[model samples]
Target: MGRGLPGSISGGVKRRGLPGAAKEERIVVLETENAALHLKLAEYQGLAGRSTSEVLQLYSAHGQQQKLQRTSVVTQLHGTVKRLKQDLKRLRSFVLELSKDFQRQSKTYLYQILTAVQGIQLENEAMQMFQIKAFDLEQSLQEVTERYEKEKQKRRALHNSLVELRGNIRVHCRIRPLLPFDAASGHSISEDRQRNFPEKVAYAADDETVLIKCSRPGHASINRTFQFERVYNALESQDIVFADVAPLLTSLLDGYNVCIMAYGQTGSGKTYTMLGPQLEENFAFSIEDESELGIIPRATQEVFRLLSEKPPGSYWVEVSVVEVYNNEIFDLLAKDNYGKVFGVKREVVTTREGKSDVPLLMHETVENAAEFLHLVNKGVQLRVRHPTLVHAHSSRSHLVVTLTINTIISGDNFGTSWEDEQTSQRLNKEVSCTFPQKMRENKSTSSSRASSPTQLEATEKLKKVKTRLQLVDLAGSECVGMSGVTGAALRETSYINRSLSALADVLGAIAEQRSHVPYRNSKLTHLLQDSLGGDAKLLVMLCISPDQKYLTESMQTLGFGTRARQVQRGQLKKKNFPVPSKAK
Candidate 1:
């Protein structure tokens, strides 16, 4: 099987080999198939790798595109955000401007409203003032018209009365008593003469008759006849003299000029009559209501009483007390040297009603009777005194006390129909006239005047009706022989006598209706000229004493009084006196 087997085997081998070869070939084919499969797988793998690469590339491209798109979107969003922010900024600016505009407009509107309100208020106030002023002016005009009409009627009536009444002289008589002294002791005594006097004594006012009765301790009465007003005692008669002059004092307060003088020999109670008796208490007792009444005290009391009765602003009084020693004027109220004297200078001033004299003197403000008495006492203390044969403590010089009073009279309120209607019409007119002016001016003044018609009428009436009063106390007319003066007192007595003589002459001239009366003869006469015959009511008090020692002097004093009574004072005619020029 080896050799044959070899050949056969070889053949078999060949066959087997063939088969094996075929198997081998089959195996090879399978291997090749497997290799091919492997190669395909590699290809597939390559293809998948390439596909995956392509896909990756595609995804990368897609991612790059997405990134670009996102970048673009973000840029666009940023631009949009910037645009929105700009728009917001612009809107905010617009809103702020609008708010500012609103605020400004609100302020302007408020200011305008406030200004308008103020203007309206001011206009209302002005209108109210204008209405008031108009009413006041109307009332004033009516009052003036009525007063003018009344004054015209009064003037006409006065003119007719003056023509009907003829000028005539009037005469009056006065008497005074003298001081008493004890014959054995040569001292003054206070005694009652009424019991020792005769039962019946003849005294006549027409003949200027006087009867004097004297009484002494353990002695019969002494009777004497004199042409004078008689007083048994100075103390007893002083009050009588004051009573007699009381009416004169009343007239002075009623707008009259009065002059009172004690004319007699020295120690005839001239000082006592003018100044009252000196009291041991407060020197003002005589003026305060002692047993004796003085001329100065009575006059002052009357003046004050009248002043009190009048309205507060209606009356003003000025007093001046002077002493004439040796033809020189000495101011009693002056506080300088006691013996200092000044000359009398008289000036005539023309007032609205008449002419008046301004005497050079010191004026004093005496508010009450006590104050007046105090001034009078001061004057008496300063007066020259000397012991005299006729009497003790006699006045050697003349004392003059003058009172000047200024007054205003208000028109009476008559409730007549005519007056009421006239007043109403005047008020209306005044209101009409003043309304426009008041509106144009400050409103305050217009409002005050326009409120009341009565106030306006009162103001207009106050412009008219001015009056003045004068009261004068002249020095006593004395006889130098009875006064027993020496040196300066003698000279003073001479001057006093001369002045008295001149006064008598003036009275005589006035009595005779002479064309020209010498009023400039002496200071006393010049000062008394208006009081003697002026528009003011006039009164003269002649104080005299009754005693046997002063019989001759009493007669002379009575003769002076008689002459003064013969001088008639004419009615005061309304005279337009010239006012002092501004240049003067």
Candidate 2:
């Protein structure tokens, strides 16, 4: 039964299996389609992942390029901004400088405009006043001219008289105050006058006399009165002494040779009188006290002042300084820094015109007193000085300063309208060669012969005047023992004494009126031959000390001065060029 049932079921199942098989086939097809879709989805998923990676890489590169471009643009903008800021700074600096320049220019223009306006207003006012005062000014000028003419005549006459009377060789005596060293050694010089004049052995009697009293062993008080041209007491100041010397400088300007010399014993005041104490160290004429200036400085100042009183360029002043040490001539101006004098020994030569001059001597041209003082100071610095027991600073040589003055006068109408007898003689001699000139109408008459007015006027322009001034500071005479000198100093002392003795001998010969004066005995005398013999005006300043120890030396100096005063020379005449007439 089971087999029959299985077959029937199988037959029925076949009918149902056909449908079931078709259902299975449909299910398999559906599974196959699903598998194919899965495969395609896997392929699509791999492609999508690779494409996503590539897209991500391309987006990163694009972002990098955009960043680079933006960076470049920003850098350019920054550079442009920086250049603009620099240009702005330059423009601001230029504007500031232009503003400053404009401010300065405006201030200057304002000042100039104000000044011009004020000047124009003042000129208009001055023009109105000028016309009103013209007549009064003319009258005043006429009155001044008349007064000037009268004063001119008087000045000319006074100048002539001074020239005549001031020609004598005068001797003056000056006594210095007692020094500290001299006071320390207080010895009774006079037993009688110890109470009143303890150290005053020599006393000034008057303006021209000095009384000296000395105690002798046997004889009663030896009283002697020495007469000089002038005597100054110890209390007298330097200015008072220079008052007597100032007129000599004026005589020099009038064309006369003037020589002023100082002579004294050692430790007296020779250098102080000639040149102030240590003035070379100061090197200035503008001293705190003008009265302290010595004769040389005073004379130089007066010379410059007088030169300024006249026209400029009318005179030329030249100065030279020389020193004589141990009978040797040395140019103090010609020296090196080491105090060694340069060049060969200068010889005093007498020119054909009978004038004495040292050849090759250095002459420095000086304009004012300051320049002259500087030059003189330079020469003084080169001078030899030695400290001695008698004087702390003693000049070891004779210093001579010479001033040569050359003057040019345009015409005879310069200050003087009339001609004197000497002028007429000089003019006549000069004009005789060039123009036909006759002698004076009368030989006895001092009046000049009147030449043709035209010829007289023509010759007036050829006048020139020259004069020489010498300032000599002689070495102080010293006693060898008192000066505490030996060796080379002793030899120098001997030469100095010898030269002084020769000078005294020359003066003695002149006083005795000898035919041949012993001027060639020493270089000093030989150099002073012109000043001693001719019409050269000479002045001797005898400086003495009030110290009792120098009584003997002072007496000797007085005696020497007395002998010098006896020397007589010809009348001094002004040196001037002869008027030249028109050449034929």
lDDT top scorer? 2
Over 1-584, each residue of candidate 2 has an lDDT whose tens digit, in order, gives 32254445446656666587765665556556666777898899999999999999989989999999999999999999999999999999999999999999999999999999999889988976886588678888888988887886576457445534544467899988877766432232344312323366788887678889777456567689998777999989989999989878877766678899999887788888887766445332334567777899889888888767544444557777888888888876665568554533677776788766677776666777887777777677777777676776778888888887655554553544223445445444544432332221111111112447777676566454667888999988877756777788778888888989999998888877788888878888788788877657888999988765677788889999998877666477667633222100
Using Cα atoms with residue i matched to residue i, what is each candidate's TM-score against the true structure? 0.50, 0.59
For model 2, the stretches where C-alpha displacement exceeds 4 angstroms are 1-168, 184-198, 216-220, 279-286, 335-344, 410-464, 577-584
TM-score of 2: 0.59
RMSD (CA, Å), each prediction: 32.8, 21.1
- Residue 275, model 2, lDDT: 77
lDDT of 1 by residue, 75-186 (tens): 9999999999999999999999999999999999999989998998898898788877877777787788789778855764464345224222222234433223512122
Error of 1 at 536 (Å): 4.1
